[model samples]
Target: MIPQGPGEEDYGALSEQRKLVLATYDLCAVCALPFRDELRWQVTFDDQLQQMGETFAFNEAPVHEVCALYAAQVCPFVSSPHARLGDAQRKGQRRAETLTLAGFTHTATVFGHDSELQVGESILMFEMADLRRIHRLTGADDARSAYEAVLRDEARIELDDAERRVVDLLCAPTPKGEDSGPVMAGAAWFIGAVFCPQIRRVQAMKKFADAEGDLYFQLAANFLDNPEMMAEWEDSNDASTAAAMSWFRTRQSVPAVLQQWRADGARRVRDVRGRRPRAVGAAVVVPRDEAAIRRRRDAEAALRKARRRKR
Candidate 1:
């Protein structure tokens, strides 16, 4: 099951739906429309069949299907990041898969019925947007043709200089997972630096900023120096700002935060860091050799015949 948040309990100091609004600012990650139409998901995901019981989170916000596809085409992480940074830092949850590219698996919605605990009768009530899947680009030259096949019209996705730089890295291939650890740590700087992948909503935020005149940047530029204003975002009704506030309050500059992540990741051994993921349970398994099986069966039959004769 996709992540459902801390489960049934209202978080923050707000009503349920409002808490989600605070969680994801009531907007689509791709298009920034303040409403969700379809349950959006990645085109592909790591099917760790062997680790079926383990948990995975997209750790980003929701998007329109079209937007998700658009992201699949242009967005660096969706196109394919260097690695799959799972919940290795935490206990219980298994380690994530790291690869060259993360292709689009597919996008889908949940099936549910109505009730009181689920008055809305939804498995995912308010905070579904927070339940994002992490996908990535695997190979160097792969997906480039597919990426070029589509035409993009992102006039609304306005980017400041800082954001543009990040996008540039996404489009490039130098600082990939295998080539460099630090640059490719969590597929993106904001992701690597953040405590939770769910909280690192910068990809969706590029659109969210355009929808709101880059309020986050304004807040970051202004309130980052002022403790008073920063607190207001945390306490305010503007959910996106409140979400961004979590990062600001972390106190480490984004660069420093990411750098530390890289060092820690490099220092930790792979097995010690986490287990490798191989999707299992209903997963396809290779069959044993037919001739060998027949030989074994014949031998067993001969032994049984001799034993019956002796009897």
Candidate 2:
């Protein structure tokens, strides 16, 4: 449950502080732990899809695929077809008949400001990659199918050539005994290219540049003008990086480049931490599964203890 205020718990409303923590650390909304898998999932409604389509940015923080499926099956508001959304911010919105379980590999923080340019609200939005439709009428069965399908890796989006190139460039190891400044510049470029919307990409880049130094900004600008310089600077750099760096280095007008990559079947890829194949005969949990519920509770307790220890 999300806390609404001091000592007040709200099932429907999200805590602003919690949302920031989840976004900053890339933690799962359900387990409040770092992701172990490549994909992140979010629950969406038919009305949202109709308005924004499959690639729409989701304001809600993402959950683990398993958590999403489990919630779909067990959460009273989610599982009931006739129930309204009950979102405090948007009251009286009826729930859609079919809900979507959308998966993605990338998320970005969008900051909103007041007239004086003071930061007001920050929303963590995710890019869609894959999805499954769940019919609320069918209840647990539909949720179960979606869960099994994800576990089987069905409908998984693989990184394409362009995307793989971008990942490789961004993740390139800095040479031993060398200044990492250039590489950090590359990191800034990566953030600009992948994590920001076009409207704010330049602003994000400027912020990063200011933090690094004026020279770093100049170098980044040079890379934007002559992308081949990135390849020349590091002989190990690949042709793909050189090909893509033009738009990546220039924070301005990079969305078109991303759109082109997507058109070319590009999908984001990320490091998988502690992801291992499930053993044969492993228990597949469904709705009203007491064992699964207990396990989740245990995991949550352990996570809380670990976090407390870290503090």
Candidate 3:
């Protein structure tokens, strides 16, 4: 047989590598442990998390929840809720199908794989393991904060500023006899449930809020998940999730903060309404998009990590 290059030679050797026991599996990225009862796998996804009937691992490593949270916060790549990879980073092969390190899932070793398994040339093949839960870490600051708050408050479920606002908005008496949910819409609800995720603590917050507000959103969301939370919130009120998130995100600030935003929003609305064609008006160019600015900042942070990896 003709000899191939170094990369090819390594591939051939890996394809024939002997199967090893589970004890020799890869170590946890954070703790450096070979095995654990609870493990998580970071995945880069296109349309969804579980696509093509396969699960993905970030750099082929598992991590503990504590480690993952710290990484998600400090790691620029994982912190972005809408971060994307460029063609070169993706190896320039799937240019059109740009994949992002979308999220993570709880996974473990399958039954037979514990006995024996081998790594493939460029990938590892294993049976489907239990996918206990999924965490969408993109734009995860609010969600992560809520989770950490819950963890820290072991004595009692004291509502944070955001949680308190959600409960207050939910429990307020409405024109109808029953109270209504927050004003966030379906799309906004998705952002909250999947990204910001304050609604996850609705029930616990209820212990402090009230004995009522059944038709209210945060209460109903205690039992419901993403779809159910969105539907119930929309049914109770016509507000968008953005509106709800805005309230929670800024509730701690002065109450008049939203009023100032509304004033600015009103001026923008008026400008758009009154816009007219100009004979020689060159378009007034605005600065970068919010996502672009965020990407640049994150890229700097990621570059630091890359340099560390190289060292």
Quote each prediction's TM-score.
0.23, 0.38, 0.29
- lDDT by residue (tens digit), candidate 1, 52-81: 243322323445544555555564444445
Candidate 3 C-alpha lDDT tens digits along 91-155: 54432232223323333221111113223212222222455555554455744673495357423
Residue 179, candidate 2: Cα error in Å is 41
Of the candidates numbered 1 and 2, which has the greater lDDT value? Answer: 2
Decide which is better by lDDT, 1 or 3: 3
Sorted by lDDT (best first), the order is 2, 3, 1
Best by TM-score: 2
Error of 2 at 139 (Å): 2.5
Question: How does model 1 score by TM-score?
Answer: 0.23
How many clashes would you count in candidate 2? Answer: 0
